[model samples]
Target chain A: MKLLEYQAKQRFAAAGIPVPPGRLARTPEEAAAAARELGRIAVKAQVPIGGRGKAGGIAVVDTPEEAQREAARILAMDIRGYPVRSVWCETGLSIDAELYLGITLDRDRRRLVIIFSAAGGMEIEQVAEEAPERIAKLWPDPFAGPQPFEIRRLAFAGLKHAPELHDRVPKLVSSLVGLTSRLYEVATSLDALTCEINPLVLTPEGNLVAADGKLEIDENADSRHKDIAEELARDETGDDGRSGDDPFEVEARKRGLTYVHLDGDIGCIGNGAGLTMNTLDLVKQHGGEPADFLDIGGGANAERVHNALEMVLLDPKVRGVFINIFGGITRGDEVARGIIAARDELHITKPLVVRMTGTMEEEGRKLLEEAGIVPAKTATGAAETIVQLTRAGSA
Target chain B: MSVLVDRSSRVLIQGITGREGSFHTAQMRAFGTNIVAGVSPGKGGTDQEGVPIFDTVADAVAATGADVSGIFVPPAFAADAIMESAAAGIELTVCITELIPVQDMIRAREFVIRSGHQLLGANCPGIVTPGQCKVGIIPNHINTPGPVGIVGRSGTLTYEVIQGLGQGGMGQTTSVGIGGDPVMGLSFPDVLQRFADDSETRAVVLIGEIGGSDEENAAAWIRGTGFDKPVVAFISGRTAPPGKRMGHAGAIISGNTGSAQSKLDALTAAGADIADTIEDVVRLTAVRLGTQPR
Candidate 1:
């Protein structure tokens, strides 16, 4: 649900948080065209990740020819596994100060927090680390949002270290008050878990403009904001999607399964998030690395189990599959039948190990045994068995 | 003697006519929970499995005197169900629905809090008191009433401890899944406080995962409150890669937080024994209790 930079800027603009004029360019020619129009533009990769500049995913070009060249290079670049499908060409800003502003959920407090910092831009890395007091946080009343008075105080606290801008304190405070409030509005309206404008530039002309932005919507809230979700969906597969998105994941998403790809040989599946994670940890503990984290999410049947197995084995790196089910709502027999069915129908030669427990597991255990698939006694035991099985197969 | 639920606690099903609601209703009833009423918006005045169905939580509460509500409504409608239960003055509302939008939860949680009631799990396995009452989907017959109080983030893992520990004759007073969702009701400290006050409970087994600061917060609460019970803590997701977006928040919220090591270190510093594996969780809790792992 992480929106790319251009998309986030659009939302920011709509919310009255001023952003530099930008055009999303899908090709080198588009970027060139954008440079011609915007004049002295910055071509940035449209990946939903940070540190793009360090990764060489961003380039500033004064000429349309240079813009095309940089865009071509960036568009072909793999910035942290996300293939750059497009670039954001924005009109360059004047020499000015950069500030950090963000709105996100403070999970511990169960409230929205406004993060403001006068120390922003590239020169200061780890501002929060090097100078913790510089970054001021204000938790808005969930029912009321941020008040103007509180926002001004936050602005003052965050600006305490930046004494260079002492003269325009009043104007800065007013700008921050308006910007943060609008960002909060965008956060609430979009069900944004994170709405950030890093290096919100204060221009030489005294105007505040968001230089870079990020907006990640809450996954659970997407159903309520279907339009937003679909409109700004991550180009997960690099074409009409974000890069680094595994085809298995795309398939899983389509089938309504929970799966995350990992770089290992043991394909892990479990009934719950904790159990699934434990499955991965157990594999690592047992001298085997996990290939993926897959949660069947309860009420598993033959079809779902088959789908999970297929999805896991789709990775050629997957040497073996281990399913750890501490069944509560999902029955053991159904899980066993699914495993057996997957084994038979998919013709999976990869060693499959299952540890099924809780709620009619005996029946499921009997079915697996009958199918010549032995169910392990414990999750640790299952991990041990799978690791051994995969080792033997690989060796 | 159970901290949250017992035989005498009257329970109502919010989405009584729905598939999950009807199915789990039977399950809960079979576990000896006193099923008093059901709330289905349009199916009022009808009875499903002999439990009278009311149009709203208020009407159901009025007729059946149900203090505890189990919500099985879909994610889209779950928040409304929670607020409905809260508004109707239900003392404890346990929502078993998962994936309810966080915004919806924030509002529901807010309403529940402002109304002076407790809401557990919009995406959680409901609380269960062994041999007395089972409110949500924790399997029945997994226990024989005893001394330990279990609070966990995972529903199935909670069942694991119950099956292993409880069946091994280390029965629990109650096992509550606070839920794995980052934004959830009844955190570790909140539940720990309950277990602290419960006279029947002697020890607690905390099953935590690698997200949010709940475990760290629980650790702090344990140390700060000087809680006397022997707490055997186990955390999952030791092998998880920190989620990119969530990791950013974690980095900003606190320095190098929301990892297994951080939670473990915090808990260890707070005088809680850590279990490396689920089996270790059972073995360590048994050792602390001066019993053999069964």
Candidate 2:
């Protein structure tokens, strides 16, 4: 669950981290009111995605009238796929330097990592590649908070050339260390996957403030954080209880099925995660674009299979459906019955190529043949057939 | 002759009274796994499926001498269950539950490794020795005892590879699913090293997906260690879009990292035969093992 910038900044400020005073404005009037409250302001488009600054979603204005104009302009624009619903009017700061500070779990290393760089305002990956030496990484003891010395070493390296800023750097580093510890606690308590503060700016007054913030909590941990979950639900769905959510995905989740919407014409459904991924790969390899990734999981009956098919057919882009199920604990015959039932009920006109192997596959194939759908003998053959069928249909 | 669990290994099922636990316990017992006892908190002194029940792993171990634990507990309690099993000095613990918080797993992993007990997965299919012993939920009927060894980060896809091998008359010595979680007990190289030492295992089939650097690390290990056995590899999620989680929590492509193509290239460059599909895995395994493909 990705948090909007306003939410992230709110969390950051509440954790005792210094942030530019900001208020979320939903309209031009609200923007003007906020601008009046905070003289010089930065009207930032409140969206979940990055590159908002480069996309012209952020506007710096000196007066209330200018702030309202900028807010109206940003609100009318779209960044990536999301519409700019609101703008964050924040007090514009006089920054001396832009630095980076982020705490994220390194999935490969299986440890908590803190990334700090003197060179900020660009993607961390680019900084890592272009000037690796400027960035300092520290793997802090998760059980024991990061020591002051460890924090100082990374922070001092960024401000090493300036002898005048040496005294303030330690204070800044200590404060950052304190902020990071609190941030880690918040992340652990909420089971957040990442907490990032990019371009943590340094002011001439020797103050460090977070200019931008991003927090992504794990969806699986949402149940444990009910308030956060409810908050996100309200924000995403709006008060009217409807948004740009895919109906198929919403229905699939309700039915306890795993479904991901994707672009392309081939609807791929398989029994397991590995097999489903392999099915999608094979489909694309055979020149078919996979419309979605769906895993029906183990032991599916007629009703579940019907649900799976209906979800696939719900996507207008899907010209063909590929059901590549390798039944181990899942019985193939039952799956076949579900597919046929869904096909009949939904009045599906799209082509479906199935490759049902293992555990009573013959019975499943017999049922498919009876329904005038020929099952492929091999996984590769099924993938190829689906691609060909979709191409033929398009032609 | 098998890696990890064998016929003589006494097995205890955690969360035995739960729906998934009860079903898999029967399946494991049916496949000739030594059913010693079960552990479900507050359900001790009772029996489920003729296996004696204990409230804790320590009690179960004391009574049944069960050295291996197959966890079927819910995600919330999975970490504690793993730690409990490790504290009891169980030699091998296989966790079938998925979606345990990564933070919890890190702590649990540290404890398990410190205790010298191996943890397989928070989300995994467990290990199986064809016609010998079955631990978790991999369907036992598809396997046959032979020379080829299989290790994977997936459940049913590994099963598919095993089935393909069986269909092509290439039976397996042992097949291990290292689990799909980002943090797991044993990795591809860990299982690969064990397979290398086991004489019953001749050729190996490695199934990897587009996530983590496990496959690349396994390849590097293979190259460095100079393992002589033939290894065939199959990497899934070649078509997976970047930043999309593909069912498994750990199986996602972030930026330029954890791509299937990168994993495949690394494995191939390290001298592992790349199997384009499950059927291709069968053919490659047969060729590597000096067996005629059916």
Candidate 3:
């Protein structure tokens, strides 16, 4: 679960990471009041995902009236697919230099890496690509945490060109290292997957502050962090920050199923994550683009399957449906019942090629046969059938 | 002998009293796995499926002399469960749990590495030697004993590929699902190395999805060592768009790295036949082994 910028910054500040004071404003009046107190402020759209600045979701204003106007404008606008529900009105900063600093789990290395560069703000990746030498990376030991020397090394390497930043940069880097240590503490303690601070700024006052923050907690590890879970639950009740989630995805989550929308004609559903991905690949290999990726997961009951099918069929672009279930912990018979129920209740006329095998296969196949739904013999065969049926229909 | 588990694999299920643990435990027993004991805190002294339950992995290990552990614990306690398995001196530990925090796994992995025990997955389907022993959640009936050995990241994709192998008159010696999490206990290279050593595995089928450099590392190993076995490979998520987590949390294309095209190029460079489709796996396996496809 991704925390909104304000939420991330709040956690960072609580962890002793210096951050520009910010208040969340839901209305133009609230924005004006916040700007009045802060004097010069930046109104940032409170959306979970990024690219807000290019989308005109960010506005910098000096006057309270201008802040209110910008807040109203941002709130009424739509950036990408997300609606601006709230504005993060924070005191604007005058920076001596912008330095990029962040820590992310390098999935390939299976370790935490601290990424540092002189070129900060957004476009850190672009900097890494253009001038690789400017960026310095350090892999911190999970147990020992990031050491002061390592941070100084990375800071000196990345910001060597700026002679003015020599004395202050080391201090900033040390604070960042401490902040990173705190971030790691929160990550391990709260079961967070990622904690990042982009553009850790060196102010004209020679103080360091995290200009932006992003923290993503692992949703599966929610049981361990009750406070965070409660906060997330409370956030979900209101607009919070999840503004652009498709209603279908939300419904699927409620029903204990996984769904991802895609731009294709064939709807694909499978019993496992790997199988679901393979099903999508198979669909494409057989000359059909997948409409969505849906995993019913193990031990799914009739209702889950019914809901999964219903959600997939909701996509009008889905000309054909393919269900690839190799039931192990998930009983084949329950899946068969769900498919039959979905076919009857939803009145699904589109072609559905199901290949159900393992764990009560006979019973499941019998149910499908009785429903006049001829199941495919193999996964590839099922994909072939769905592709053929959809192509034939289109022709 | 199979690469990981066989009739001799004394299997113990961690979190055995839980829903997934109990369910797959029963499946493993039915598939002829030597189910020796189970471990679930506070559920000790209780018996389920006629197997002994213990309070700790150490107790379970001491009582049953179990050498292999299959974990089905929740993500929060998954790292502890793995550490427990390793601490108990289990030779091999297979974790079926998913969504373990990367930091926890990093620590767990470091601990396990120090302990010198092999960990299979934090989100894998485990290993199965068809008609001999089955561990983890990979469906038991999807496979049968043969000369082909399989190693993969995704559970259901492995099952689908198993079915494809079967449909092509090829059966598996042992199919190991290393899991689709960012961090894995046993990686593609580890599994491939085991498969190469096993006499029963005349040919190996490698299944990988987008994300991570495990496949690339395995490819480099194959190229460096000039592995003798005819390894056939299939990479999923060719059409997967970047930034979308396709069911598996680990199966996402990030930037220029972790692309299907990149993995395919690496695998091809390492002298492995690529399967574009599920059916292509069988065809490539047949061609590599100098046999006619059924």
Candidate 4:
């Protein structure tokens, strides 16, 4: 759900907020063309993570040729584990003064805060660490809009030789707040976890612009946002880098489940997202690498369970499959039935470790045993079993 | 004799027609909750689990005299749903819907505060007075009515701790999941205040995760208020690396202040009896509350 900097700026421009003219380029040729259009530009790598400049992702190039060269360098690079897929070609701006503006959820106060500073182009974290006094934060009145006077004072304190920019700063702040509120609305509407615009910049020409943007929509809320849901579905269908043999894995993906192909050889499946993640962490903690994060949700029937086991065991790297169920709404007996059904249908060659809790756990365990699968009594026991299986080279 | 709700509390379920709403509603009813009315626009005049269905919260409240509402509206309309309940004069509104936009929550929270209405969560497990009323989706089987008041942010972790309490034969007065969302309706301090004043609640069990300053703030308040009741605390995600965001949308520890260690230190410094594990929480709570072994 994270929009690249260029995309966010485009959104800001669409909302009537003045943003520097920018073009996104996936290739060197596109970068050259973008640079030609912008004349003098800053070629910046388009990575979702921050600290791009310090990581040498941003370069100021005077000509199209230089812009293309910088774009090539950036696109070929991986700044912070995330590979730079494209470069943002933006028009270079005259600096009368630099200032920062952003809006984010303030969890402690249980409100949204507008953060502003005269020192733009610096990370907000750096500002907080070094010159905390320079930064001015304002909690906007939800009923009455952001106060101009409060923003003006903040801008005046953060910027140098920008008295002329003072009047426009508050106006821009109001607009930024409005944009943030709108973006938040869109994000929530789409079930996004976060939508952020960092280093909302102000230029010498008294123009305000969003320098960077990051939006991460919540996957849980995807069912409500049809547009995002369709996009996700399309993304899944179009992704075919890994194919064949892993039919169970393919099936799981088709069913809208996240199935990561890991080398650690332990296939981990669970009912809840939190439990799955914790199980993965515990597996890692216990010297076992989880092959996948497969959450069958709270209502995984017999068919889904069979499909899940097939998917996990299909991974060539998987030597053992671990099924952990903390049954609350979904009874343990249902999970047990699924395991039995899947075992009957699928050729699961790998050793299976099942840890079932809550209602009908004993019944579930009995069913698993009847199906020739020994169930682990505890989560720790299951995790240990996976580790032992992988270490002993026994499937 | 619970903090927020008990057997006599008449509950109304909003968004009762939806899948999640209906499922949890059935669970609550089975757990012996006084679920008098169900509300869902246009689905009104229909019945859910034999509970009388109403078009609006007002109608549900008017007919059933239900003062407490458990909301299951989706994230998109959750804010509006909360506002409706608040406007309808519901004294306490428990919103179980997760992933509500921060803006919507801000507006909903402001409106609730302005109108003098109390709201619980936009992403929470709801409140449960063990052996009495179960509102929201906290599993009823894991809990039992006792003398301890429990408050937590995470759902499963709270369940684990409560299960531990149950296993130790230490039932709870009321266990409230304040929710793991960034902008939740109720804070730890807010719930702790209620627990402090409640005569039936002899002790408090606080379950916190790394992220927001809610724990630190609660620690300060607890220190300042001088609540005589013993508090046993367990902070989860301690092994969670700094800057690594958890599954909860609100679960992110950005700086040093919001780290698990810092929160744990704060709680410890505030005189809260610390428990390393779920079982340890049970043992500490029993010892602190003078609940001897059966």
DockQ, candidate 2, vs. native dimer: 0.63
Candidate 3 per-residue lDDT, tens place, B117-179, comes to: 999987887888988888887777678788899999888778878877887888989999888
User: Best to worst by lDDT, what's the order?
Assistant: 2, 1, 3, 4
Off by over 4 Å in 1: A122-125, A232-240, A245-251, B242-255
User: What TM-score goes with each of the models?
Assistant: 0.93, 0.92, 0.93, 0.84
Per model, the share of native interface contacts recovered reads: 0.62, 0.63, 0.76, 0.22
lDDT of 4 by residue, B87-169 (tens): 99988899988767667788798888888989998777788998889998777688888888999887666776777788788
Expressed as tens digits, the lDDT of each residue in B172-279 for candidate 2 is: 889999988888889998999999889989999999999889999999999999988999999999888898778888889988889998998899888999988887
Docking class of 4: acceptable
Q: Individual DockQ of the candidates?
A: 0.55, 0.63, 0.69, 0.34
Best-matching candidate per DockQ: 3
Worst 10 residues of 2 chain A by lDDT: A236-245
Q: Every prediction's TM-score for the first chain?
A: 0.89, 0.86, 0.88, 0.75
Report residue B186 deviation for candidate 3 (angstroms): 0.8
What TM-score, to 2 decimals, does candidate 1 have? 0.93
* lDDT of candidate 2 over A1-395, digit per residue (tens): 77788888888888788899998898999999998999999999877778999999999999999998999999898776677788999999898878888877887677778888767778888988988877887777656757767877767775564455667776777766776676676677767788888888889887888899988877667678777667766666222122345676666676777888898989999987899999998988888889999988766777888888888888888998999988755777999999999888788888889998765688999999999889998888999999998999999
Reference-based lDDT, residue A107, model 1: 86
Q: What docking class should model 2 receive?
A: medium
- Model 2 has a clash total of 0
Give the worst 10-residue stretch by lDDT in candidate 4 chain A: A236-245
